[model samples]
Target: MRLHRGGRLRWPTIGLAAVVGIGVLWHGRAAPALPTAEVKTGELVDFVELRGEVKAVKSVTLNAPSSTDGDLQIISILKNGTGVKTGENVVQLDTVKLQRTREQQQSDLKRAEAEIEGAQAQARLQEEQNRTELMQARYDVERARLDVQKQEILSAIEAGKTKLRLATAEQRAREAEQKLRSGRAAAAADIESKKQKRAKALFEVQRAQRGIESMTLKAPVDGMVTILPNWRGRFFGANAPEFKEGDRVWPGAPLVELPDLSAVRVAARVDEAERGQLSLGQTAVVRVDAVPDKEFTGTVSDISALAKIDFSTWPPPKNFDLALRVAQSDPRLRPGMSATARVAIDRVPGALLIPVAASFQKGGRTVSYVLRGARFEERTIEIARRNREQIAVARGLRAGEKVALRDPTEEASRR
Candidate 1:
């Protein structure tokens, strides 16, 4: 080795020593081990996921028979899950009071009919009496005229008296004619009043008959009988008792449901944020919570135009209801079954994609931390599109490149 004067190191050798010192400082602390994922070239799908329940495409709900007043107590009902045929008896109400009312009305109807007949007979008799009086009055008038004619041929004193007698007979005929007219008018009015009363009684009888018929409810179609909740029965819980024997049901209240199991669909609610993405005929994959292994294909059949408030919380979130038609129906698919659906809205094939968490922002530019050897190199990446869980890289990334899931500087400092 060559030495400089007075045992000092050579200038070139001193520069080399300084370089070694910097290298030692760079390797002093190890780089932090970070969670990483490789950028992959594959198809990327953006989908909206919704949670909901299975329902029937066609469902028939049977409401309580309409009543004028008070509630209808259930006397007997079919079993909750019993299969029923069309025109079969499904429910029977307590008709004891209705029966009593019907009997009373029937008696009233008979009395009304008897009154009508009696009134008709009296009207006929009154008509005959009036006709006889009218005829007698005409005869009296003719006899008075004959007496006046005789006055012209008799003696003077007798002729004067005969004229006076004719005058009195004519007066009596006028009074009889007035009586006949008044009697006929009074009898007709009395008959009309009685007929009106009879009509009222007949209406009551018919109404009572209809009420008795409404007490017995029958199945309108063939399907399984599913009992509906009695909303009035409970006061302090989300669930209410089902309609059964001895239960009091109100008018227009749902009593039972008949769901057509041949056609099934899922009824789900989409988040308000994703409401705009839903459209008719969009396809989806549905998975039932009860049957996890199978995935059913479905298409969107209906979507609500307006949002509804979710009442489960204070300041509730808005939600939109949607119906998905299942492509195929299975026997295991029953109404009220819980299910989840994933609806694909957009897709990209053979794209460079990475986990969304592996990307970060710096200096108003999108970036990703790449693991290179013992350290992480920060690279700026251009984003093409993104979803809830993944992001598609448009530039500055290639397939098989490793990206750090978190900030490398922060993790390294902790280490």
Candidate 2:
């Protein structure tokens, strides 16, 4: 009975060992393989992304003229953003002071005119006196000539008598001719002096007229009237001078901004490192945060030749700014919109492409898991073009080649 019991125990132990070995073999064969996808010839593009803001293509800031001062009072205010025609009154300074000044100037001008008239009268009187003197001198000269003729006849009659008489008559005639020439020169000088006085009075009147015109401020161009705030914080409250009515301003101070709506563009800043990859006329895909559902196409219109340096409280920062024009104009577009842009740098045609996820880095080279028969094998590939979504494999990949989409965990199980 003991021998029979021993035999039974041995058979059970052997049966258990065989079952354990078969279980291990079955588990190994049943382990799942890594996830995989096929590599195929397709098109791929490489691009760079940048954050930017939308702004008007053309904008001008209106400034106060240099001739304005704080003492100039604002008499009237045109509503902000009011469309105005050329030469329309945008701001009217308290012309009361200017009007008073002009009135005083007018009085002075009248005084000047009276003085000019008086000067003219004096000049005419001087000319008449000169003419009368000249005429009297002429008469004296004629009388001298007649006397000299009589003397000459007498000298001829008495020619055998006295030489002293002839000499005295000739001397008197010469003296009278000299007096007439002096009177004529004096008359001409008196007329010229009156003409000079009249010219000076006319100049004074014109100068006063210009001062009056300067007091009235008019719009220089056909655009909206935007008022700028005073620098002293006296006119528009304590807030920074952005826009307001009755703000005191100096000449050339920017008071308004006029944008040409016909042309619009998006101005964006690109990272300094990525600026080299961008160029004018490059196509871009833009997405505005305000309208996220819609995407717009644009072209790189302009690029800043220099990088921007931070001069504000936030200092020591730099970035290159770029401008892009929208492919189509939309009336809904406005300035100050936040946007994101992607510029294509390069593209490959008919290249072997695969999901970026499937590619892994190993041994200083990019690699992907190629599936062979029932198992995945690693292959080093040459990447030609790559973007955020896909990679173009230049070598070690072919059309219709199967590659793993995810890392292989089954390999660990096999090991």
Candidate 3:
């Protein structure tokens, strides 16, 4: 609209004219002579920065199996920190001695069985011989008894001889009966002894066979394999040696581990000062050092109730260990990878905020120098809350307004 002769500019119109006169300052402003920050409303997230490492949620451990052959010598083993799949061979123990023992035991078992069979046959033969001898002794006793009966018709001297022969035959019969009873029991005992030996040999053979079968160890889950430290290794020093080929381990000792990689977590340590800022179920973004291309989103799965002190430094700083359960577990994530986490402790949505440095107490009121057309106007502001870096403003500020970081009057005075 064009101005007419009768038109007059009011106070409000004058104010609008002055603002437009400043080169349309509302759309954009010229470079400020001093540092400044904008008053804007946005979502604010308080984060606790944590430095830690990536690890699996759970791990599968494989220990050296108990060996019956008295040998735990590892013939082959996967290297430490090697990735593996389920059912993959992890360690192969030396089975040569076990195989030899098994073969020897098996041979012994067969020999014992053969000996039992032979002894049983011998017992049966002895039993048959005993029965035949007993029958012959009874027949001899009966013949002698008949001779005694004929003594009544013989002469005196010949009758006495017949009677003596009958007595001798009776004594021999008793001896034969005793021998038959003793021999039968002895044969049965001998057979039983041989059978017991066979049973023992069979048990040994079974145990050796089991030991031979358990020689090769395989991965139980898909993960990274970390060889357990050999405390008795040849190179015993500050650092323990990792299990490898030709290493002799004790029976039932823990030898290797397969960490589960499907569900991964970040183990983080936070300073005690930041402990209160984190809680379970808070969201986090973790970046692994090895996998720099990915940022895995996760939730705070666990928080330590106790604190761990760092003794390497003076007046040790107490820290708490917490775990973050990753929502998207990339296959590339591995245990012990250095990870950094940004845990959102708290979130404020749609809050009007300004830099903490923008406002200061002046004349008993918190005030900031807000940008006016070609000038700075110091205005009193109401602050609802504040964090280390930002202050949430409850009043006296609007979005898109620039506030001076430092007093422009002070800058002019310094100049």
Candidate 4:
């Protein structure tokens, strides 16, 4: 039986309602996972751990010959991920056009040589003709002078005629000499022009031969061949095809890569604020996504001298690009794999460390929930060192004690 609406319920009824209310509250909220970790007695490392992507140290790309005369079409290519040896051909371009050009250039070169020879022969003949004409004119002038001398013994009319003949012969000799000089200069110019044409043809022939030789792309090292995307094609977005047979590629287009698997690296960028914390030769431990179980050791090989702006956020924060050269290469490590790296900067011996999430800021004090018996005991902690994922406690904590990874007070309030 139920009590009247305005009347108070008896103890049994009140007790049942309280029980139901508590059950409903417990059922409505599922318990949060209490991730716990023990404070460990070990050397505390002041480390900077960051997420990065794994990349090869020498991710070298094989590009089409930059000296090519024009665009080259691939005639043969190795399939993607094909294992290759040093000096092995990875891609072969169509040599038909280059070969034809070489042949044409050779022909032009031969023609120019022949033309030069003919020009020289004509020049020699012209020189001989000019010399003969000048010599004949001089001889006629001499003969006319002799006649004028003989006319000295004749009458005035005969002497006048002889003088006129000598003057006319002298004028003809002068004209012949001028013509010989002009003809020599013209012949020299013609020969020079033919020689220049021959030089140009020779250069073209050499260039064509080189272009033909460069059509076959070779791997520089012994590694697996990875076909690269066609630089000429933006036609396919993420599904863009690799440089394959029958693909038209321009000069200097990257076609393949013989990545050095034995030596790899993790390329990462950090915000500008962390730039000063990093330097060359620092030891870094990299854990790649593909090789989930293995840890790779590396050193800071390079650090960018300048900061690059990241426009992804407001205020355009700057980031520094750095490379971590893996000391030893593993076969499983590949470029473009996600990786996480921890770089140890400094260390403290015999220090107690705990999960960073265990600490909470309560009443301006850093406190953590220590699991004592069946309940959590809140104790203020003194942090001697701290990092991204861990914190070293100087006081208020001890080795071998389990701590709650999350705020226990917040969970109690929710309950």
lDDT per residue for candidate 1 within 231-332, as digits (tens), equals 777655355678889998887678888899888899988878898887998889899988887899999999999999875455778999899998877877
Backbone clash pairs for candidate 3 read: none
Please give the CA lDDT of all the candidate structures.
Answer: 0.84, 0.69, 0.83, 0.84
Q: What is the lDDT, from 0 to 100, of the residue 374 in candidate 2?
A: 56
The regions of model 4 sitting more than 4 angstroms off are 1-35, 51-61, 68-76, 94-104, 113-196, 227-254, 310-317, 362-364, 407-415
How well does candidate 3 score on lDDT at residue 408?
71
Give per-model TM-scores: 0.68, 0.56, 0.62, 0.67
Q: Report the CA-based lDDT of candidate 1 relative to the real structure.
A: 0.84
lDDT of 2 by residue, 1-415 (tens): 4677469689888999999989877554532466667888887877888777776677655555455344554556676657777787766555565566556666766776676577667656765665666566566556555555555567565553344444544554555556556655655565456556546655655655665576556767676554554556644223445545565555566655555556767788776788899999998888888877789898999889899874322545687878889776555555556788888888788988899998988769888888776556778899888899898888988888889877665466567
RMSD of 2: 8.8
Order of all candidates by TM-score, from best down to worst? Answer: 1, 4, 3, 2
Off by over 4 Å in 3: 1-39, 66-73, 79-88, 95-132, 148-178, 220-260, 268-279, 303-321, 353-398, 401-415
lDDT value, candidate 3, whole model: 0.83
lDDT of 3 by residue, 2-41 (tens): 7876468465688889988876654464434877889999
Kindly indicate the candidate among 1 and 3 with the higher lDDT.
Answer: 1
The candidate that wins on TM-score is 1
Q: Please count the clashing residue pairs in each candidate, in the order shown.
A: 0, 5, 0, 0
